[model samples]
Target: MTQKSSVRQMIGFITDVTRWSLSGGIGYQLFLCLLVVFMMLGVFAYLVQWKLGLAVTHMSDIVSWGFYIANFTFLVGVAAAAVMLILPSYIFKDKDFHHVVIIGEVVAIGALVMSMTFVFVDLGRPLQGWHIIPIIGLFNWPSSLLTWDILVLNVYLVLNLSIPAYILYCHYNQVEPDPRKYRPFVFISIFWAFGIHLITAFLYEGLPARPFWNNPLMGPRFLASAFAAGPALITVLLVIIHNTTVFKIPKQTFNKLRLIIVISAIINLIMLFSEVFKEFYFPTHHSLSAEYLYFGLDGHNSLVPWIWTAISINIIGTLLLAFNPGKNKPMLLLPACILLFVGIWIEKGIGLIVPGLVPSPLGEVVSYAPSWVEISIALGILALGMFVVTMLLKPALIIEHRFKAEKPS
Candidate 1:
């Protein structure tokens, strides 16, 4: 193709993407509108936060991190979970996942976008976030896990975005993508996925002051829970796509994903149990953090109920996904996925971060709760992610429809 023709095609593709994104069913439009309202509210709340300062948040000098960082940590795991699908479809050559591997990539992109947004919103001086840039800012590269996290996350985002964009661009033009061009990147992405979450875990585990977070198993636990939560969300999203749109995902593919969710959830449970045993069995100074989390230390028990609720839901989700009855019933599967997703979010988001700080290294107890403004901002961040995912999926679905039209019966 000539350069002029290529430019014309690119412009045409953008036009189609915009049109398809705008054109959706009433239900879709309503959902989009709802998200916009939440986003606007979130923006208002963030402006208030920006105006007043972090003082508006429940975070004190002792409990410095709150809702934003919790979500950020959880989403890093969710973003890495895309590797679960990428491995089977790309490495194992599973034809069943070929059509939906793009879906996983899209999920990764959306999750990363949210993760970065949370990081952005958490900043007191949002403009100074650019300090992580290599040459312009003091990234503290060799010494800081956070610097490593910034590098891996942005690179992973680019890699995930590029692979699917290339695939969809080829499909948009009714041409087959060359594996030679994109397959190597797919391989690199698999390792990069692990690196992104590992670096995130190190960000916590390397903190010598927080003994609760300085566990050797933090990385493994993060990976296991990430695989469970990530695949569980993808499963729910796939079902929504299957029901609401013309896109058809095979039951065999669903079954494969179900297996991944089941195994990962089990591994995550085992790790959780192992931590409980380690914490409660010997009972050291470090045990106070876990004690405060699970059963409450002294008179403080703010997190006890939330932690147990997370555990109950996780157990229920694991059992539901493991059984034949739940596997066969779509209704049961959907709720199980929700339970697992919510359970992990609660566990990792608030449950993981708060305990480490509650019983400070100096043994001072300070309770932290997200104020209304913090909650509003979180809802807004989530709404923004859903909007992006919804927009991205529309274009991809349109391209899929075009493929179906061209396919020979």
Candidate 2:
């Protein structure tokens, strides 16, 4: 193609993306408006945080890490969940996942972007964020796991964006992408996905002072919960797609996802049990964190209800999903999946981070609750992520549907 033709094609691609992204129903419009409102609120709150300092939130010296890092940690896992689909669809050539693999990749992009945002927000010196740049700044790359996290996350973000952009651009132009061009990225992404979450796990486990997070099982637990929650969220999105659009996801796909959720949930629950037994039965100094998380330590039981709620939801969701009856019913399946996702969210969110900080390694029991500002900011970040997911998936579904309709019988 000549330069002029290439430019025209690029313009056309831009037009297509904008057209599809902006086109939706009244409901979609209202949803977008709502997201905009939340984004505005969050931005305003973040500005306040920026001006007044981190004190606007509920974090303290004892609980230096709060909602932001928790979200960053969980979202990194959600981002990694794309690998589950990529590996099977690409390496094993499972055609069932071929179309939806793009969906997972797009979701990864949104999650990763949100994860990066959370990290930025968590930084006390957000303006000096560039200081982490190699050579130009004082980054402890080889000596610091955080530097490894920074590298892997950004690289993973690039891979997720480029792979989909290439594939989706091919679809937009009604062409097939060359496997050799994108396949190696797929393989690298699979391992890179694992590395992102593992590095995060290491960040937590490396902190020997936080006995709650010092467990050797932390890495496996992160992966298990991630695989369960990530696919569960995708399954929920697939159901939404089926209900709203002409595109159809195979029931078999949901069934396969159901199995993944079930197995991963069981493993996660088993890990939970192992932690419980070790903490409650042996009753060591490390057990204080567990006791505080579940039953409260010294009249400070704010997280008790939250932890139990998470546990109950996980159990109910696991049983419902594992059984034949619930798996077959969309009504049951949808709610079960939601429960599983929210359950893991809570488990990993406050349930994972807060307890470790409570009764700090020095036996300081400082309770932390997210102020309205923190909550608003979190809601905003979540809305931002949803908006990204919505916009990215819109053009993808449009192109996929066009291809599907154009295919010869």
Candidate 3:
């Protein structure tokens, strides 16, 4: 294709995506409306915060990071989890996985967007975010993990969006995608996926003052939980897609994804156990954060109940997956996946972020709870992500269906 023709084709592709997003059934439209309402509320709340300042939220010098950073941490893992699907489909050449890989890419794009948004909102002055940009801002490079994180995340987002767009454009044109053109990007994304999450983990582990996040296993634990939670989410989404739309997913695909989820969940649980044992058995000054999380520190035990509940739910979910009691039944499988996803969200979000800063380095204890403003903004960001995913998926599904129909039998 000539350069001019390629540009024209890309414009047509975007036009189709917009049309499909806006033209859906009553249920889909209602869902979109609900998301829009929340988005509006979030925008209102953000504006209030912007005018009033971070003081409107509960974060203080004692607990510098709060609700926003927690979500950012979890979403980064979710974004990285796309590699689970991509690696298997491309490197291993799993044909069944190839059909669904684009779906994973769409999810990654939504997640990365959310992750970046959270980072933006966490800033007291959102406008200062320009400083993080490479040329326009003073992005401290090489030495700064935040700069590294910003680099990897933006690159991964572009890769995910472009690769899927290339394939879908080819399908729209009723032509085969050139592997030579896109395959290199695919391989780069697999490694870049790991880099984004690992760098995010480094952001925590690099902090020596916060012993709770300083473990060497932090990166591996992040990866394990991400692989488990990410696929669990995708599994639930696949079921919804199969039921609601004309597209059909293969049974083997579910089986393969389930296997990946189970293995990763087990590893995540084992790592959790190891970390707990190390913290409780030795009982050093460094273990204070863990103690604050699980028990109470100086009678301030806000996180105790949440952590235990997350652990219990995670155990139940993992067992449910291991036993296979439902025998591939959606009734059983869906709940298990939901449980795993929610449990990990809690474990990684509040369970991880809050404790690291609970008992301040100076031995002061400060409790943190998100204000209504923070909650509203987070809901808005999450709704926006769902909205994006829903819109993107419509055009992707249409293209996939058409491609399958036109393929030579």
**C-alpha TM-scores of all predictions:** 0.98, 0.98, 0.98
lDDT, residue 77, candidate 3: 95
lDDT of 3 at 75: 96
Q: Report the lDDT tens digits of candidate 2 across residue range 1-409.
A: 7999889998999898998998889999999999999999999999999899999999999889998988998999999998888988999998888768888998899999899988888899977987999988889978888998999999999999999898888878878789999999889999999999999899888888888998899999999999999999999999999888888999888888888889999999999899898899879888888899999889888889988999999999999999858645678899998998899998998899999888886798867778888888888999999999999999989988887777675
lDDT of 1: 0.91
Which model scores highest in lDDT? 3
lDDT of 3 at 22: 87
Clashing pairs in 2: none
Question: Clashes per prediction?
Answer: 0, 0, 0
Query: What is the RMSD, in Å, between candidate 1 and the native fold over all Cα?
Result: 1.1
Measured over all alpha carbons after superposition, the RMSD of each candidate to the real structure, in angstroms, is 1.1, 1.2, 1.2
CA lDDT of every candidate: 0.91, 0.90, 0.92
Instruction: Give per-residue lDDT, candidate 2, residue 197.
Output: 93
Which digits, one per residue and each the tens of the lDDT, describe model 1 over residues 1-409?
Answer: 9999999999999999999998888988899899999999999999999999988888888888999999999999989999999998988999878778888888898899999999988888987877878888787987989889989999999999999999899999988889999999999999999999999999999998898999989999999999999999999999999888888888888888888999999999999999999998999988899999988877888888898999999999989988848554679989999999999999999999999897976798866789988999999999998888888988998897787689675
Per-residue accuracy of model 3 over 99-214 as CA lDDT, tens digit each: 79888888999999999999998987777777778889787998999899989999999999999988998999899999999999999999999999999999999998899999
Residue 52 alpha-carbon offset, candidate 2, angstroms? 1.1
Better of 1 and 2 by lDDT: 1
Q: What TM-score would candidate 3 get against the native?
A: 0.98
**Pairs clashing within candidate 3:** none
